[model samples]
Target chain A: MFDLKPYLEVQRQRVDASLKSYLGPEDASNSRVTQAMAYSVMAGGKRLRPILCIAGAQAVGGDHEAVTALACALEMVHTYSLIHDDLPAMDDDEKRRGKFTCHVQFDEATAILAGDALLTLAFEILATTASQCQAAEHPKWLRAIGKIASAAGCNGMIEGQMRDIAFEGTVISIEQLEALHGLKTGKLIQASVVSGGMVAGASEIQLQALGAYAAHIGLAFQVADDILNVTGDPERLGKATGTDQARGKNTYPLLIGLASSQHLAGQLVDKALNALAAFDKKADPLRAIARYVVERNR
Target chain B: MFDLKPYLEVQRQRVDASLKSYLGPEDASNSRVTQAMAYSVMAGGKRLRPILCIAGAQAVGGDHEAVTALACALEMVHTYSLIHDDLPAMDDDEKRRGKFTCHVQFDEATAILAGDALLTLAFEILATTASQCQAAEHPKWLRAIGKIASAAGCNGMIEGQMRDIAFEGTVISIEQLEALHGLKTGKLIQASVVSGGMVAGASEIQLQALGAYAAHIGLAFQVADDILNVTGDPERLGKATGTDQARGKNTYPLLIGLASSQHLAGQLVDKALNALAAFDKKADPLRAIARYVVERNR
Candidate 1:
């Protein structure tokens, strides 16, 4: 065993610290929007996207410092999505990570502005980072930014969210459900991994391999999420169970049965691991992460 | 004297066509969110920001084609801000540009998503444009992106929106009102002009002049807006008049008398025109636009 537990703990702690530093300290002079942004982002999650970003960079022999800004940007985008998704107009979620959601803590208007601020800040960070780099490396950062934006933009996560909203309370085929999840969740995950590689100057072949690995793990991650929604402890999950079912939202388990969903997740994890066979121990975190994606309780 | 009417009309049409092209064609496969986005973006407006961007580039001897994507990106960002500002949780407005607001035409959730999609797309276009540019010009594009992002990010438009909402129904000082609008509206407008100059490789001195010019015009524009809110025709303005008074929102005319506010706007426009002293006929449009900002009925 590669001791994935300790590895995850260390990476999560590092990302958490970097995120706090990147967001900077909050004084009384800080606006309510900034406070809300800090509150939501610091409210704690698995930090999965940022951790994957770091791992992707590391797999190509890049250092943690090299991807710190990029990782923080990814986390900011993820946090913004959560804030907006939890709004009254969307999921109407009152709590997340066992804390009051942004809109619940602040007003709905503040929450919306906070989400907008975070999304804009993500690009600010990206553009600032690219500007700071040497001219030779500027293209890499720009390419990574493009990847992240596409993953978050109309044809990717946003479109997926639209479809998800439209499909609510209605049944769709398994393929459609998979495609939806692929857009909503899988694309960002794929971007996280591939962008890290891109910033690290990964070869085209390596980038393709990382993309393949991420695609598998991304779907597996969502499938595990569906399973957790039905079977996990609410306390551990920091949210109520069966939200998808209650909303009449489509899920892998809902369409394919729980057993098949679990099997499919396991198989995806295996495929993800296989996609990383060319890399040495440097890719251990990615490999361990794929396993953790399916096997973790929450 | 410069014939600003024909100039403005021609530039507006060019920007309108470019915006349509940038957004691309809508088809049956498009999601409802996309439809809502198109519906709101295609609604009638002055197209001021994009025009300023194009003018800024031209002032630096850059052709229209050179800054087309950037101009479209600025318009998209401006449109996204308008959409969000009209949301029920924010302005709660029912109409904008003589049409039903995004939240009114579509649902609140769809409107929110459309705004988000447009914001994300703006950055996508910026990053893609930077990526497509020659390596020699890449730094300038990245710099422009940094400037735009900072103008639109936490300490910029979003914070301004937060403060605006917080100040609703509460009287504030003149300085506070000016500061609020400076961030909320002035910053993006400044970025529009400066980013255009930047993409066209304006010298540092030229950029500073453009910045000064934009700052003066930006504040003048808002002062004029306050005057219009108090005095303009409801049908001409698209939305109702006296909305500032209805919301108890602070305005120039509220802080000072209407005649004094008008005087202040003319002074600011004069300052804006004086800021362009170094430029020749190429800067005529900017000078004319500054006058238009204060003189327009709408």
Candidate 2:
């Protein structure tokens, strides 16, 4: 068995350690915001994006340590997104990851600045990582950083967020919903895969294959999330069920029927697994993760 | 006479044109957020940061075109800062540059996304600029991007902003005021100067002098701003006066009194001019700009 849980547990600790070193828990001069940033990121969650980043590298026959910094950088960006998404003006989420949201725990302004700081910190980490790579790989690192920045920038995640807010209380088509999540979540997921391939110095063909795999799973992950939002147990899910319907979000289960939505997720997961047919046993983590994404209740 | 006004006007137009092409007035798919971003930036201000960037490059005899993208990138960053600073959770200002603040013009969500988008675009422009430079200058461009990101990132601008919000409604000393603005205002201003020098491939000695000139003028700029907030005419300033004191913000005038603050600004301009003495006539723009920063009504 691929045993993804053990792998995830080890990588989660590794990511947390690197993040602590990269952005320390405190600064004598600037403790409050620093503390807030470290607090929310350290509070805990599944290190899904970073794990995917590592898996992407391993699938391409690259060393996992080579991508540790990039993996942490991606997680930082994800954390920053959550902090901003929970703002009073945005989703107004009072809790996240089984704890009070950043804005709820700290004041709003601190939370805003913390999110901005974390986003900016992602670039800082990537730039520093670029400098640390071998001279031959420096250009690759730079390109990877740029690609990640583009995915999180206006053209990708931020664009998706704008659409999400604008579509509130308004009817949106299924195609529009696909475009929405594609930008918001899919782009970054794709970037994580592509960036890992770049670190491995993979060929353009290999990168495209990775991209295909990521695209399928990106959609599947969101589909599963929609189903969980409607059908999951609150105690296991760590949040209320039916939040998407309550918010009137255009979700897979909302537009498609619940049974069909589950069916769709399974199909997507199969597509995701098939994208890795070229790889050998080295890609087992990805193979296992694809199935886990569709089957996990939480 | 060092007539910097014509030079500034010409450069302002140049920067605006590049920004229009880089981020057009509208996007067919994402018009709303794009328009909000373009509106605040293209609405027109002095373009002080970008002009300073050009002057910094020119001081070291670098071609202006080499720094054009970097200059525009700085302006985008400056615009983004204003957008975020005026948010409902922050300064809560409803007006900027004699126009309704972004949050007031659009919704708070749009304003937040616009600010986020503009910030992300800054990195995009910088990365694109890196690709256009000479092969030998690639590393320099990458380093420049990192430096600019660091200056604008958590350890620099955002850190300063956090301290700003955290220190609200508290008594602060003059040293604390300088430290606050140093990160909030000084760091980015310093980045603009440093980035311009980096684009020109300035030597260590030349970069140091440029940095000294920037340091003096950066503080002088904020000192001027603090004074104007108390004494400026709202129509001329394009924003309300006395709002700083009303918010109980730590300002130069509040700590050192108005007359002393004005005196300090003049002293800083003198120091800035002295630093540029070693530079040739090409540096006249830097000298003139320093004085203009203090002397201008707006």
Candidate 3:
């Protein structure tokens, strides 16, 4: 009986604390860019990627301490993507995480610099983490960093984003939409889990299993998001539903029927659980998260 | 008796070839982001940063081949900075390296993603390089990656950029101007040399000397730019002169005097050369490069 609410709460708090320390105390000399970075990072979310990272480590019998910084780096990368995506030239979104977006809160130039800083800082943290580890552990950290970098880079997330922008206002196939989400949203999520396994010195086979688990849950997470946008109670979600339809954004339910999208999400959760069949009970947190990914109201 | 011109040409060609291969061939499936990245990266420039990296490695008795990927990573980081700085929300420049700026050549969203891809590609290159190294060499590559990341990140180059923007159209002091340039332009320059030395397994004292050499040259490079802006022939520079003053941008020439700025640049070059006193003839390329930093009209 792993009560996921408390488990998630504890993990979210830990991640938040690490993020605050990593960004450091804002001094008078610390530029507005740092302030802008902190503003968005602290705005708050579910800490889903970081939690997935920690769970991956635990499932492999690795100490959570080993990948705490890496987890924070993953969240930073996610936050930077959101900040950039919200820019006037991109999504032009004025709000995120229930707060005014970075561009809306600060000037556009400062927001851009802040996002750039966060992305650069993520790599800085990864390399710095590798430096502090024992010599024997260098390769593990390096491999993890390499995996995360590729997942977040041009051939991965950026390409997905470019595809998303290009396909906007045009009819895209269901396959195309899934492929776009796989690259844009799924790649980082998958990398987060796989990188945690890497940090724990998991075998190649174990890493592959983790990758499979992540891929299923990653898509499930997106499908759930699209469902919530269509069916969620606005009060529980803290926002209006059907905005995806209003913006004509591609979503699982929009491409497929709502019933099929829900069925697919449930099937994805089942597949995600099956991917962890070889692991012991230490994988319970991951199993719980998969269920919650589809069940969460918001 | 080193021929600086031929040597620089050889090095520039090598860096270009490596950059081309690193970005890979464009495919029809390749999104516009990759195309934009290749366009800006392949555009002609002095390739000064990569050359400095190679020179740093050579000064430490390390083969230039050892740092080729690292050198290319430095150039990519430099290119990303230029691309973002030219965006409409930033400098709004229409041209760079005698070609249309990234944002001008491509749409703003594509340009943003292109700059993002280049920046992310750089770290991917660094981690991939570390992963490919022998176990004993892993620490060296990791240390170099850490150093480069911090230099390119918020507390270093980004902060410098923030200050440069914050100080624009203001009457800034000479010390403030130097500090601003030191952060914006100097940190990456210094890191390029220092990280290359790290990659070559230079001794602490040797690394310190290289750092000192880089610091002087970095400032000299900027001072020369200020002097050029005041006095350069537009034909030679391929652009208009005095634009720094026309835009009320802070510069050594504006804060001090043209004669004083020129004298300062010369003094910086001498100091840079003196910093390499402990190095052998292998340091000659670095010496020539330092002299060229101040002497180049463009």
Of candidates 3 and 2, the better by TM-score: 3
lDDT of 2 by residue, B197-282 (tens): 88888888888888889989999999999888888998887888898888889898888899999999999999998887888998
Residues B41-133 of candidate 3 have per-residue lDDT tens digits of: 998788999999999998988955758899999999999999999999988889876689989988899988888889999999988887888
Q: Positional deviation of B197 in candidate 3, in angstroms? A: 0.8
The top-ranked prediction according to DockQ is 3
Off by over 4 Å in 2: A26-30, A64-66, B26-30, B64-66
Q: Candidate 2's error at A169, in angstroms? A: 3.0
Candidate achieving higher DockQ, 2 or 3: 3
What are the candidates' individual DockQ scores?
0.81, 0.62, 0.87
Model 1: colliding residue pairs: none
Better TM-score candidate (1, 2): 1
lDDT of 3 by residue, A55-114 (tens): 999899995575889999999999999999999999898877678999999899989889
Clashes found in each candidate (C-alpha, N, C closer than 3 A) = 0, 0, 0
| Candidate 3 wrong stretches, greater than 4 Å | A26-29, A238-240, B25-29
True-vs-predicted CA distance for residue B206, candidate 2, Å: 1.6
* lDDT comparison, 1 vs 3, better candidate: 3
DockQ of 2: 0.62
iRMSD of prediction 3: 0.7
Collision pairs in model 3: none
